[model samples]
Structure formats: structure tokens, C-alpha cells
Target: MSRRPGRVRRAASAALLSLLLVAGCDTGGAEDAGGGQPAASGAAEVPGEIVLASGRDVTGRGGIRQQLITEWNRQQEAKGVAYRARLVELPGSADQQRSQLLGALQSGSAEYDVVNLDVTWVPEFAAAGLVQPLPDRLVDEDVIKSVAETARWGGKLYAAPFNSDVGLLFYRRDYLTSAGVTRPDLGKDAGWPVVQQLIGVLDAARNRLPAAYAKGWTSQLDASYEGLTVNGVEAFASAADGFSLTDKEGRYAGSVAELQAGLDELRNRTQAAYTLPDAVHSDEADTLTDFAAGRTAFLRHWPYAYRTLHQSLSAEQLGVAPLPGKAVLGGQNLAVARGSQRTAAALQLVAFLTGKESERCLLDAGFAATRVSAYEDGALTCTTAKPAGQAAASPTGERTDRMPRDGNGRPAYARGTLLPALENAVQRPRTPLYGAFSQTFAGQLARLQGGTPPSDAQLAADLDRQLKRALPSH
Candidate 1:
């Protein structure tokens, strides 16, 4: 707490950050509306078209999602069920899509049967009764345990996880080799200290650094949105023994001391010496762009970046491992709209989309799978065929799907790296007022990016005060 100790701590932190700056960088990707009929309670719902609404698929147009829907429709036709599912990709960013869904459901303007809700939005939508409670079987033992927790609010299942995500550490093996690193594969046990040491070696070999390499690492740290809050939570969770900003009831439960610890960890991680200068303002897209450009050696990004980054960098150049420290959990969940008349058929569609096969399909296409089988079970292959014209034949006459996969058809790192990361990932605060919580959390943390940032104790006190205002306190 003394000025001399503070200066020494700052110097030591800078030295540690210096180690990472020389070593790494960070990287890395909606839906539809309407078409439902109203039915009175106890009356047989019509076997009509089921409209599945969601944000744009990051896998490109006619992606795996559409392929699965096409497959479902084929099955329905063969069975003469008369219930076909159509995907309605909602226009706009996640925030805009959330607003659209809320307005549409509240006004009954869009009769969407199934809605894709972000993991964080599940609580809000369920709390407002916009989405109906789903059967427990919809989220069974096969689902990833951490992901399954996101489907419930108020002690009942309201949404089924369609896909799940967690942060992962991506590094350039070529860069490390160029810098003369002997063990370029930072393996499962690689922690922040290990990364810092690696960066120091990279710094020592500056003459051999990649041409575009300007920083050790980069991440989504934009304070205007959820990125900063996510990074903050990860650091907080890593630093605090059992960090939880809000309780199960969404009430403020964190303490000033905990906030101080988290703040300090975040500061150390993002010190200007080791982080990309622009990282303070970078979102996911920006960070991915920078990382892909070879601006940084290491990147902290979501699961999809594995496929996206692979498109530009070869397997020899790209390597991914579990992110050092904690990672925040992300992804969307599927829920039936409360006003849907085709509830039963819609539920069937939901089940099929979130089934073991469908989850495998999602995993193969780059999204994180919600089921353990998608990562671990070799027998569970993605049964859905690629839509016509979606896949092209390579020179070798084999189907060319760009995503790298193992013999089991899972993402190359699915079982060993991604699965454990998802299982251990921390959730963002779950609250009806999550919008307010995130905004406040991000806005307060932005101060840390300023030239004259507040001390950890000061920032912690301010954050603790603001969060208490944004969420209820016990």
C-alpha cells in the first residue's frame, strides 16, 4: 500500500508484461423471425410450418445450421408429418437482435416458434415470460454441465443450449520457432507465468520476430460493450478463489477486496508494455483481424476462431491451447416462444437441432458443441449432409470443408482442449438487469485504460459501488 511498494509492484508488473508482449497476441463471429398461429389451450396445435429465428451463422451462408434444418425437413417429409422448419436469420448485431426479439415477442408481431437466445439473455427472456419452460430432457446428462446451467432461470429449464463457447489461447508456432523457442507447444499446463517467460525469450530474439509482430498479445478489450466485462470477469475469476459478482438470484454478492484482487490481475494482464496498444479499443472482429495479420504472437479468442484462423494460417503456423487463467463462457441457447401455436412440433424441431448428431454437426462446422458426445464420442458423426453447392471437391477428389478435424470428425482440438475449457469456463452475471450490469461493468473498467488510471483499490471501490446500483444486493 506504500508508494515505494506501489512503484516496485508497477515495475515488477511491467517486467512480467514485458515477457508476454514479446511473445503473443489474440483473435476471432444471428437469425430470424415470424410465422406462427394462435391456438387455444387444450386444442390440438396445427402441424404447420415452424419458423426458427436466430442471428446470422458465422459459418457463412447455407452453413451447417441450414443444412441441419434441410435434413430435418427431409425427415418430416418422409414421415408425412407436414411440419417443416424454416430458418429466419435475424438482421443486425447481437444487441440489435436481442432488441428485435424482445419487441417482437412482447407485441406478438412475430409468431416465431423457436428463438435462439444468447446464454446471457436466457434469464431476461425467461423472467419476462417471452420464452416457455422446456422439458428437463431437452437438456440431459449428455449436455456439457457448465452449458446446461445457462438453460435455467428461476429454478426451471427455459432454454436448451444450441451451441457453447469459451476463450482459448492461439499462438503462432512459426513465430515462436523463429524466435528460437525450443518447446513451442505451450501444452496443457502452460499458465500466465509460463507465457510471460516465453515472451521474454521472444523479446530477446527481436531481430527474428515476424514482420507484423508488434505486440506479444491482443484480446477483445473494448470498453463500450461486453468485451471489457468478459475480460474483467476472466481476470477476476482467475485472481479470486471463488469469484461471483452476483449470486444465483442475480443479486450483487462480490466484495471490495475481491474486486481489488480482480482489478489488479486485469491491470497486470493488460499493462501497456505487453498488450497491443489498440487492444483497449478492440472488439472480437478487430482483435481477430489484428491477430490474423500477424500483429501479435498470441491471441485470446473464442472457439470459432479455430476455423476462421485456419483459413489464413496453415496448421504449422497456428496452434491453440486452453487460455491461460480463466475464460468466460459464451454462445446461444434455443427456446420455444411462449405464444407459439405449433408448440409441440416446435419442441420436436428444438430437440432435433440440439440432439447429439446436430451438436456434432455444429462442432464440425466451427461452433462449440453443447454435448460431450460431440467432442468425445467417436461414433457420433454429423449425419446432416452438406447442402447442395455448399461443399466443393478438392484437387484430390475429396470434400473440402475448410475446418480441420480429427479422424472422429471433431475439431482437431475438440476433445483435449475445447472440452475442458468449456467445462471450466465461468459464466457472466445472470440477471434480468444484465444489460445494466454489463454496461456499468464495462464503463467502470474503461477507466483502467486511461492514461491516468485509478489505483486498484480506488477502481475496486468504484466498481463495487456501481455494481450494487446496477444489481440488487442481499
Candidate 2:
């Protein structure tokens, strides 16, 4: 993810490459671009205009914005629709985008009719009445289950799934093969058992490899941030005794007794003898640089890494799979703001963007489409879908954003592994005060990883308190 140098230094280690696919921190700033009614500024919502605000996607040269905005505007005019929709690009930081949106909405002056929200922001937006649940017909009638789940809140759909993302395990294929270990299938192997199996393999060959290969696994740990929360949720979601993050009512869970095993599993993995040194202090970028330099055997990152690394590494040398257990799901969703004169036009815009045709554009632009059919479009050169050496790029270079293609323009990733990971990805805790929760938990998890973990009872109590604090009574 692109950020100012100071902001980059402040990022939680888990979210380095995850700027492409993961949780966001707290909102710290506000910005505005006209077209909304304000409580004090006296700004008036423009007639026949729908403004959509969202964070900038930076996976490629232009950030992952598809041609939907221009195309939609043209289509509307062609169809004799009077309303014209435009995208007001927000800051690259999700936190800052939310802050801007919140400030605008609260002031009653924001003219944004369509708000592009992170998947995790649905509950908070819905709770605050900033955005309205979509009509049944506009919702994805045939979307993938994993992504479809992101649009619903309190049994009602508030948003439409657009693009999606998940964590991936990037490995040195050349190193693994030479070391006589075949990389395990992530979706097939599934969960913590396979993590251990792979861990064992790495441990066994730790001394056998060149001394430069110092660690077997490298992921975000020993820090408190959304990444820590995501790592915990992934482990506990499938761990023997891990509790579900949502209760019977589908709200953020209150009890933590069942989460202990998941936390323990996290401890087990972080404290593993083969983990990269200084990992607790390294952010995603540092670890990625190290991995590219051949310092580690395995890395946990977002799929976007394939693009950046493919500039030099061959498909044979770089392989990606789903993270063991599960990976955190990340991406954006389109919601209609609660107050807008052109709600109908706004909904139409949201539908068009999230539809199959637009999904193809999203994928081509380096974002994972929520529509399953987008992958089947002959354009994507994904290993799971097309034959090896058979791949295609978007006419405008957007397809490279969806999945990586080699110099010969062949598929550089195994969609078989990557797709399933995105499909099975889980959410971090769904709370309005996610930033607060992430900060508190990241600090605690860092303590745990730093060899000063609190007792399970204490950890549980603190977690419950944090979760409550993240979504207190209104």
C-alpha cells in the first residue's frame, strides 16, 4: 500500500502488503469535494448529481480504479438519464476516508449520494444511518457466498459487494523444490494442522539451507493492530475451541472463553523456533524486501505482491497459496448514503459498478472481482483457470491488476489456491470502533509475542472490554 514515509512507519506489521486486502486503522482526517448538504457550511446537494467517495487503490500505476465512472456516466447519458455520477477520490488511507465521510455525513452537508465503504464499515454506517440497505433486486443475486456475506447487516443488505481480497502465502518455489519439499496445497490441506506440517518441514531444513535463509515463516506478529485481530480471528475461527466472532444474534461476540485456543495457536505460531528474527518489529514492506532478497522461506502477504515481485522473479521461483487456517477478507462495497435527492440514480450507479460487466473491469484493474463469472472471462491468466503459458492482459493494462502475468504474458499464480483463499477468508471483529479495538489488541498481542502475555483469564477479560468499547451503546 502507498503511504507517506511517516505513516508507513506507523502501519501495523500485518497490513504491509495488505494495503491491497485487509483491515484499516482509525480515521484521523477529513476532506470534502462538494455536492452534499451541510449542517453549518450551508452547502447544498446538487441536483442531478451523485457523488461517490472512496479510498484510492494503489496496486498499480493509477491505483485500481476501473473505467466504471466514465463508462457509467456515458451509459447514463445514452439511456436518457438526467443524473450524472462522479467519483470523488478520497485519501489512500481507509481511516482517513472514513473520517472524511463521517464528518461530511454528520455535518449534513456532504453531497455524496453513493459512498464506497470498506466491507467492515457496513455495520458502523448502517448503525449511524449514514447509508441505507439496498433494495432486494439491486443486491447480488448470484454473488459468491464469502463476498455476499459482507453486504448484509442485521439480516438486511446494506451494500453491494464489488471487489474482494485475501491474505496469501508467498514462497520461494526455487528454494522449496531445491530443498526437496513440495509446497502444500493451502485449500486442500486447510487450517492449523497444515500450518504445523509446513512448519515442521521448514524447521527440519532450517540448518540445511544457506545461513542467509534465517527464518521459515514471516507474517505480522508481536504487535497490536487490526492485523493482530485478523490473525487471531483466522486461527480461532477454525481452531478446536475457538469461539465464533458473532453470537447467535449475529452481533460481535461477548464471551471469550472459546477464543483461548485460538490465541494459544497464535502464540504457538509466533513463538515457533523458525519464525524470522525481528519480525515483531518489521512491517509488511520490510519483510517483503527481505523475502525478495531471499532472506526467508515463506511470507504471508496479499496477492498484489505477485505484480510487484513478478517484475524480476519468475512464476517458477515465486508461488502463492492461501495462508494456513484462513486469511482476513478485505475490499470495498458500494452503499447509498441515507440522505440524497437522487437515491434512485445512486442505486443504479452502485448496481452498475457491482454488476458482472463492471466486475470484469475491477478484476482487470488489479482488484479481485466479487462476481465469479469475472474470473471465467478469458482475459484472466490465472493458473487455476487457464492452461500454463496461456494468459491475457487487459487491453489497457488493468488485467495485470487482477492477477500477475509473466514476461511471456502467462499466468504467474495458481488461481486454484488463490481463489479458494479469497472465498474462505474471514472478517476481523466487526465493530464501529475498529481502530480502538485494533490498537488495544495489537498492543496486547505484541506483549504476548514479546514474552509478557497476560493469563488467558486476563486476556479474555481485556478482549471483552475492548470489544465492548469498540461498539458501545449509542
* Error of model 1, residue 28, in angstroms: 29
In candidate 1, what residue range of length 10 has the lowest lDDT sum? 23-32
TM-score (all chains, Cα) for each model = 0.89, 0.77
- Candidate closest to the true structure, highest TM-score: 1
lDDT of each: 0.81, 0.62
Pairing residues by index, what is the TM-score of model 2? 0.77
Could you list the CA RMSD of all candidates, in the order they appear?
Answer: 8.5, 8.0
Instruction: Tell me the lDDT of candidate 2.
Output: 0.62
**Candidate 2 segments whose C-alpha is farther than 4 A from its true place:** 1-49, 63-66, 77-82, 182-187, 190-212, 222-224, 248-256, 282-286, 376-415, 433-436, 465-474
lDDT of 1 by residue, 58-120 (tens): 766677788778777777765566788899999976888999999999999997999999999
